[model samples]
Target: MDLTNFLKTGTYLKLKVGLSEENIYSCFKKKDLSKKYYYNKLDKNEGFSYFYGDGALEIMVIDSKIYSLQFDPARYPYILTLFNNIIISHKTSFELIIKYLDIADIKWSFYQRYCHSRELTIKTEENIFIGCVYDKGDYKLSKFQVFEDLYNGFF
Candidate 1:
């Protein structure tokens, strides 16, 4: 599956928003890393989902529905290509990232400012939201998210 498209459009291959947990499970193979990753003896939890391998990944679940997808580039070397010539890397600086978006004429904005890290969000042409978190120490890319719902508020 083209993950770039998924990040930009919020649709995983043929899957769409509001799909059941079972649907998500069927779409991707997942390893139960709960014990290894979370140190939880339990097998599974309704509040969490996993796609652990290669790069560290996490999913948020609400009422058995996929809420969002998150990726950690710092865990593994991964490059995400959003458009023809636009790509995101772990070491990509905030200024460089925003420059890429601006060059592509993509709409984006600073979503929030935090003590240790800050967030920037971009609404795709599909109206889906994609967010990135940058480290305060170096202002490098830390992680990014693809949301399943519309969010207009800022904090």
Candidate 2:
């Protein structure tokens, strides 16, 4: 995946395991606070400025069943960490997109580059979680693909 372009246009969808909408919103607000603190550190190191400006994040309910909280790349990690520390604090599953495409019934391949490169087929109706660590002027979100039929595998 093109990490640069991906981060630029990608939006994150975070699933709150067992929290109410109001609780999730409150926690997210606190997470944004921490993001501002960490983001300043990131900025000093020449990383992307991570901040929750107006409309940077939003909450939506789809189909009267699914509730999601969306955020930009800058605030994504912070929100995840907030859920981890204050809420679950153990295991969390969130999805990331390299880029948004219009086609819904399509398949794509995700690739990673290191000393060698590797690729894998990304199946449709699957959400992915990535573990990322920032270092040496770059961030790496490890590849994890979860099939829609195997939702329990991630939770």
lDDT values for all models: 0.55, 0.31
> Over the stretch 1-155, how does candidate 2's per-residue lDDT look in tens digits?
12222122232333342234345344456565224222245444322122243433444322222243333334323332321232211122222332332223223333232123222223222333333344454444333322123343312
Q: After superposition, how far is residue 154 of candidate 1 from its true place, in Å?
A: 9.3
Give the alpha carbon lDDT tens digit for every residue of 11-124 in model 1. Answer: 655556567767755766555433223223474453665555454566666667766666665665445655645656667776776676566565665443322336566554
Model 1 vs. true fold: TM: 0.63
Looking at model 2, the pairs that clash are 84-89
**Top model number, lDDT:** 1
Alpha-carbon shift of residue 46 in model 1 (angstroms): 5.1
Q: Cα RMSD (Å) between model 2 and the true structure? A: 14.4
Which structure among the candidates has the greatest TM-score?
1
- Estimate TM-scores for all models: 0.63, 0.24
**Candidate 1 Cα outliers beyond 4 Å, as residue runs:** 1-3, 15-17, 30-46, 84-87, 113-137, 148-155
For candidate 1, the lDDT comes to 0.55
